[model samples]
Target: MGNIDKRNRLDEAPFRYAVTKTNTVFIDYEGKQIKVLKGKEAEKFLKRVNAADSEKELQLIMAKITGNFKRGNER
Candidate 1:
């Protein structure tokens, strides 16, 4: 996870999430919608996001949820 933190700068804070009235979660990166969660998944994600201590931690959680984001070795 340290490597991930190194690759993803906390200063930039590239992840963002929006929750709808219908309990749907929309996860985005750099202004692009990347993942959506609903039902139990959205509930769980909301819980985790609420429990996150800082923006950096929240960013990491979003990155993990999105999965397989750029790892800096693409050719």
Candidate 2:
């Protein structure tokens, strides 16, 4: 996780999330939608977000939820 922070500099918090009326979660990175969480997953994600202590922490959570976003090999 420290590596992730060092690589991405989540201090700027590039990740964002939105919840729908039906309790679905949409996670976005750099203004692009990347992942969706529904049912138990949505509930769990919301819990973690609500408990986040800071913007950087929230960004980390979102990044983890999005899985492996980039592997540094893109041309």
Candidate 3:
């Protein structure tokens, strides 16, 4: 496996961080990578982290964002 893969697997739990490339940014939760966020969306994500809420909330937010993305793409 690649180094990043090995590192992720070696840890007892997943890591969280914002991934940035080009003009996009997203939060990585567990092994899932989201890539449909910017500006206010990013601010909201950071606020979630700062609020010290559960991972479930983050997952829900990710799901919501993903859902919106899928819907938008379908149009």
TM-score of each: 0.85, 0.84, 0.41
Clashing pairs in 3: none
Stretches > 4 Å off in candidate 3: 1-24, 27-34, 68-75
The digit string of per-residue lDDT tens for model 2 on 1-75 reads 566655665776778999999999999888889899999999999999999998888988887889784565311
Model-by-model lDDT, in order?
Answer: 0.84, 0.83, 0.50
- Between prediction 1 and prediction 3, which has the larger lDDT? 1
Residue 5 accuracy (lDDT) in model 3:
29
RMSD of each: 2.3, 2.2, 11.0
Candidate 2 deviant stretches above 4 angstroms: 1-4, 70-75
Name the weakest run of 10 consecutive residues (lDDT summed) in model 3: 1-10
Clashing pairs in 1: none
Error of 2 at 11 (Å): 1.4
Each model's number of backbone clashes? Answer: 0, 0, 0
- Model 2 lDDT, residue 45, Cα: 94
lDDT (tens digit, per residue) of candidate 1 on 1-75: 566677556558888999999999999888899899999999999999999988888988898889876575422
